[model samples]
Target: MAENIREHLRRLLSVPPGKGKPVFLFWLYFFLVITSYYLIKPVRDGLFLEHLGSGMLPWFYLLNTGLGLLVVCLYNQVRRRIRAVPFIQTIGCALILVFFGFRFLFGTFPALAASLFHSWASVYNLVVVLMFWSFADDFFSLDEGKRFFGFIGTGGVLGGVVGGWLAGLLAEILGSANLLIVSSGVLFLGLVVVQILGMAVPSRRGKGLADDQEGEQLGSGFGFASLYRSPYLRLIAVVVTLTMLCTTLLNLQFNRGVELAGFNGDELTSFFGSFYAWMNASALGLQVLVVGPVNRRFGPLPGLAVLPLICFGVFADGLFAASFSVLVLGYGAALSVLYSLNQSSRELLFIPLGIEEKYRAKAFIDVVFFRLGDSLAALAQLLLVSTALFGAAVLQVLGILVSLGWLITLRVLQRQTS
Candidate 1:
């Protein structure tokens, strides 16, 4: 069994690229990544709210943030250490399969499917982000990235929508906990099949010139300092940090909005799951229509700057809607659409960066910076709630004002990158 597994991985790593097959494989794999996330996140957030309440949401986010940092920080070092593995993607595939397999065969023994799912979901979030973006960087050069990232990103949106709806529908039928386990088992089975027979990406198409080197140079124990040197990287970090604060608030509001309706447990899980699906659906439309065209026509800075402005609207409207169910839904809807635009456009920004900055530096920003922002916002949320310093409206006000400053920073960053 071990030898066959090794052989399967060997084949997956060595397959040659001809037409668009390599890119297609990337889409297929990343689609599964997002699907896994969508399946788990709604339930994770809903479960956290049900068990721990709004106070705990910040902590749960902090947990995710920490996990991302740990994985990304170890990534290069890990690959280098595993000299025998040769192909790290195979190791990832094996890990994915083994975990899922354990849940399936032993799910009845203890630690129900939902328990295993949560554990795996925690791991999956960081792994997928690192893998997919690394693959994206591998396949698309700086010049081509601008043209293709929007379209490629759609795979994630579609996967999110599918995963959310599936989890919700499954919850309605089998219960959230049960369905979560089933999703895990099913995901594992799918991965096993793919690992065994999935076409290998041709070696040449899958690696950058410097990809094989894993050392202290890029992002070792410390993250990429060169990213800090790039004007664009600084602005990207600032803008994303601001955006993270807004999203953190929005995420809390979402939980609170449901609580305002008086919900918890499985019912809350189902509703939030459905709500997430709807948001992804809305985001997909904006990605297709607004994100790419706007960037191509207006240039990268405006493409990038538009997000902070959208975040301003998101915060303003969400505050008003915080008290009203109808308004809250609209607020959620607007954020969904705007976030997609922000997401697609942000991926576009990676094209202009240097090589080390794109993979290592960006990974740091995604994990460390993102988590730092979330942690800060979460702490702020607690402090404000405890001290009664301000209501939702005040937080909204702060978010909008800071976003304006972020927009100015983004303009400067884009100019430096250009």
Candidate 2:
């Protein structure tokens, strides 16, 4: 009966024989990583909103962008010197310590802690998630990526659901600061999983690369220079930048709407938690029922196009009705799609690139360029709102315009990928 169940799961996830253990390990690794992030995400947002308020979000976004660059650059350097497993282990230990420190400081330095934690959380997710996918890109072949990435990504969606649910249930009972301890514990578990995975499947480098080469430094060149030389990477960077701009604008609007609804303290934390839970739950369903079949049948083009189209509709609706419920539904829908189909497809794009492109260049694109979009959005908000030159309607219009641009860029990317 147990063997039958295992066989069923293998069939459902399209896991070929001999690949089950590594796939399962990778799935569990991603599950723990995302679960850890979601566990603290609500707390991070709530503390920032409660102590700093929504108005200061732009400055925080800019600060995050600056810090993200420094962190990713340092990450790229370290990744070059160490093997993948030890590199991740070192980062994981440091992050656990930081979380513990934040928990201790929250009581005495609420504002200062909140400010620092907010920036750190933004960079943390990017670094951790990028590391996971970069390693996966190296480990899996292109054909395997298409067959298995959707199933692998489902682990993250499930983690988001579980983590979000726990955050909502525990915030009021355990207090927001205590959630950091839980998050750290979850991250430690992820590190354990990583160690086991390394022992199980030590050779994660691409074809023709020796296992020992995994520890050698990557080719000496800036990721930006590589990004500039490749038209494909350039297009990807632009599309990603646009996506983040839309996300940042929607987030600002969502936070304002939540504030208008008069939520604060634990109530605000719980609200954010519940919101993430519902969003991830929706994503979980789509990942199981939609992403794999769609990617297998129609290919990743549809996955690539879905979010921008959803954002276009959502932004257009916001022009007529900017209610809290509308923003909730709209933002939730966008994020659900983003995390499920869109995310899997994006990672699949990296599978065909060289190792340096996969690790160094991809890190730059995911971290620095990702935050570049947020910084631009924040700057736009600061300039327009502070000058009273435009209101929320203008931002909606901007989202609509950006969505159109995203669609156009995807077409170009499709041609190149084709």
Candidate 3:
């Protein structure tokens, strides 16, 4: 009966029959961790934009990148010292403690508290999600990742939907400060889910990469220097950086729209939550219906090109008229498609590499380089919004140019792989 059920799900979700149990567990784990993050995400965004003020966003992104560097360094050190499961559990617990502290501080000095929480949340999102996917890369072969990552990602998107909805519903009742307390609980639940996955799934080292089976840990490699040495890695870096840059651009626009829309406090929280809920729902649908088939049928190059093509249209439209509704739809669609297909295709690029390259190089690329793009985009956004440097019209032009570059780079990346 279990085998029969697995076969049915294989047809439905496109997971291989042999991969059914572990993939399902991985999906559940992603759901828990993402739900935990999304629960606090609205609170973080509202507090940051409202209390810290939008003008300070560049500084926050810079701080996030700096902290990302530290986090990755410490993460590498910790991974060396402990097993993956225990390391993850310890980090999750520490993050919960930090959230508890944020809960207390937010009540006392909201502005300062929001700044701190915003920075922490920025780093937390990248670190936790990257770590999860790093483990995921270990679990699946290159072919398996192409086949099943979309289905696994669907779980995270659905979790985002639920978390966003719950946060919106509860924001007024519990208040933003107390939302931190709830997030702490949700994070703890994520750790418990990790424990469940650990018991059910075999260690990647035991069944994963051939090099990894020799039991050599990460950190022996040159890390960021490795990216410098390889043209292929350089292009991958550009693709990731550009993708994140566009995301940063959209985020600033979306937040500005929300602020202009005149929502504040719990209303702001609820609004942002609803916006995320809608975005994630779109993403979930795309991941379920389009991502896997697109990857398999059209290949990763087309998957890579999809966002730039969409953005070209969105931002080109932005050159003439800009409004709250336009920002909502345009930015949300860009985010949905990027996170759905583009993101899965991006990770697929790493699957063909060695474990060290897969993990260490990945940590740097995913965390540091990605955040570096974020920081630069934030700085650009700051200059535009604050100085009115050439105004929003010029920013839209810049986005169009960037999208073209993104398209060109996709071709370069495809050639390198070919």
Estimated TM-score for each candidate? 0.77, 0.85, 0.85
For all candidates in order, the CA lDDT equals 0.63, 0.85, 0.79
Model 3 scores worst on lDDT over the 10 consecutive residues at 211-220
Q: Is candidate 1 or candidate 2 better by lDDT?
A: 2
* Per-prediction backbone clash count: 0, 0, 0
- Candidate 3 regions with alpha-carbon error over 4 angstroms: 1-7, 10-23, 130-150, 197-226, 348-363, 383-385, 414-418
Cα error, candidate 3, residue 239 (Å): 2.3
Hey, what RMSD does candidate 1 come out at?
7.0
**Cα deviation of 361, candidate 2, in Å:** 6.1
lDDT of 3 at 353: 85
Task: Report residue 307 deviation for candidate 1 (angstroms).
Answer: 3.3
Cα lDDT tens digits for candidate 3, 7-65: 88888877654577788877887887788788889999988878866667777777887
Q: lDDT value for candidate 1?
A: 0.63
Model 2: residue 135 alpha-carbon error in angstroms: 4.7
256-298: candidate 1 lDDT, tens digit per residue:
6676677756677677678778888888877767776887887
- Could you tell me the C-alpha RMSD of candidate 2 in Å? 3.7
For residues 1-418, write the lDDT of model 2, one tens digit per residue. 9899878889987888988889889999999999999999999999999999888899988988788777766876666556778888888999999999999989899999999999889888988897898778777888898788767877888899989999999999999999999999999999998899889888466443453355334332456778989998888888889889988888887887887798869888888988999999998888778887888897777798999998888788889867677788989998998888888788777777887788667766877667788988898778887568887688889889989998999998999899
- Give the candidates in order of TM-score, highest first: 2, 3, 1
